[model samples]
Target chain A: MSHSSPASSEISFVQHHDDGTFKKTVRKVTIILSVVTIIELLCGLAIFKLGHGSHMAVLMIKGLVTILSLAKAFYITSYFMHLGDEIRNFIMTIIVPLLLFVWFIAAFLIDGSSWRELKNTAAGSKPATEQVEKAVAPGDKK
Target chain B: MSSAAIPAGTKWWSGGKSPFNLSYGKMMMWYFLMSDAFTFGAFLIAYGTTRFSANYWPDPNHVFDSAPFIHGGAPLVFVSIMTFILIVSSVTMVLAVHEGHNMNRKGVEKYMLWTILGGLAFLGCQAWEWTHLLTGDNPVLVNGEIVEMATTVKVNPWGEVVPGMMHNGHQVTTPGPVAFGGFFFGITGFHGFHVLSGVVINIIMYIKTRLGHFDQRGHYEMIEKAGLYWHFVDLVWVFVFLCFYLI
Candidate 1:
């Protein structure tokens, strides 16, 4: 396999060429990713500098940041990982399950929030009084 | 039999080349990375749920307000620099992979070295941030007196008492701070470990390229595989940035 053979030429997806297209592509990707990141940073700063204002405003800023982040993720995955050049089926094999992963997160978060609410109400009603009384009893003895 | 069916010399299920038109190793790497993405996703979602459920959460602006040389408060400046470093390193890794495809051993060596340095620099920045979190003065204004506090899994000085809650029938004395610190440290620490491993792998690849190993092999698929891992690490960081730093 180490020996140089004409057959090995067929293995690579991109034929080695003297043309600098590969270099140019890499440079373009770097610029795009960097610009997106800088935009995200600026958005974060702008939120703080401009002040959060209303809850809705803060949420909108966060939504913008998430959108920027997802854009960066797409570029890195497709270009850097070479998924863009892979076969359509191969891309789906990776991407389709990842969509499921996102769904898993959304489902679990909803469940977690419900649990949090249950815990909060439980603490608010019974545990809060019991713990405070327990504390007061100890203080009286001391 | 149909003309497309069973060519005599080639067994129908024989594993010769990639059926999926990808190398076996690369396919397996993709599978591993996809699973890893789910792990990070779960962590981030847990962080989000816990944070939103809480009444009072740490203000990211106040909590992450520290830069490298500048004193006082500069929200997210340092983390932004770290993000830039990782993105730049991903670019270098992709360039190295491109050079690998071209069988340019020297190009691969140079870019791999740069990527390794970027990883190290990011790790160093994380170390500084962690130290700052542990030791820096975080004074919370309580009853008009500034009470100094540090971040711990059990307690956090970043915000008010996490609304008291119950978990599995046990009462939580401190809710919000504990969960916040736990998730912050846990998720970021896991990501930092990935960065460390990526650096180590890049160092090995760099040494091999310098030794003409890939040149002798007549192909640079090894470097491409390593590039896949590096790119995946960078991808994970994008989400981590959104979950931890920005949001």
Candidate 2:
């Protein structure tokens, strides 16, 4: 029941008792996040406003935007969500599985495109065979 | 009689409070969020694969060209604003959690209110964007006919016009459109639902804070928990913004 005890102190919600430090940390994080977001927006605009560049250039810009956005995601998750302050193992517990999930996506996307090609080929051949059959069939004369 | 059974030392599996230094509720929330991330990942991946397979996919710049109040070809201006709003809201949410840590009820209340307002404003922006999308002219040209592109499960205004498939003997749509529209609606709609729910939760927490609920309970873990959820919503939006608007 004593607030002075170590166990009771651990249970308290406020981690850093210094009010100034907490406020400053929050303010710093907000500024960093805003700056990163603005950069992403500018990069996005540059891609189109610059007249699509080349096909390869456009792809490069798109890739850059994705990376900037991922940076934004990192800041929000680490600082805003307090993941940075959490234990190392805890962070890995969330991140390792997410990386695996990304791998899952890459694998499946490759498979999907292959299937699409197969389907397109099958559809192309099927109609041609039907047209040939129509000319040869005796019932078509009726 | 049970001295050995109690474990001689503080092993890693020692039964106690927050072995990982996280509250049980917070840990559970993290697990829930991880699972939720997978669901969103699947939706985005589906969109990516579908786009890759298509011969002609709608350019995001041309598709999302309209901004509120400043008409005439401003690509992603509106979505950029929405992203800023969500990120700002996330900042407020973190500040609220920080205040909660200090046991400052007034600080928590003030910041929470701001966070809730940010969420509502973001939703408003989304509604405007959706309206523009549904009602605005389809950017893609098809046989000199103006086809109004709207989000539909059956038709895709973004894809090439399909031939021979008809509703009442008129050719309806192309095969590419369905996947575009489907993923667009499915992923964004799911994220919107989460935002809506986050708003509701924030309001509930706001009311409780006003009523001195945490003060009575002697801790503000509830606010921290709610903060986690709000931040997750913002985090998810970053990806949604990339998939739909920027990319």
Best by lDDT: 1
TM-score of every prediction relative to native: 0.82, 0.82
After TM-score superposition, what is the CA distance of residue B197 in candidate 2 from its true location, in Å?
0.3
- Give the alpha carbon lDDT tens digit for every residue of A80-109 in model 1: 887876756667788888788677767877
- Docking tier of model 1: it is acceptable
Model 2 C-alpha RMSD vs. true structure (Å) is 8.6
**lDDT per residue as tens, model 1, B93-146:** 988887777677887888999999999999999999888887854544445554
DockQ of 1: 0.27
True contacts kept of each: 0.47, 0.40
**Global fold similarity of model 2 (TM-score):** 0.82
- Give per-residue CA lDDT, model 2, range B1-247, as digits (tens): 0011222343444455444556678888999999998998888887888876755776677668778886647887888889889988988898887777767889889999999999999999988877776765443335754455565665656565455444433334432456766787788889999999999999999999999998787777888889988999999998998888877
Q: What ranges in model 1 sit over 4 Å off? A: A1-19, A50-52, A116-124, A127-142, B1-15, B141-147, B161-176
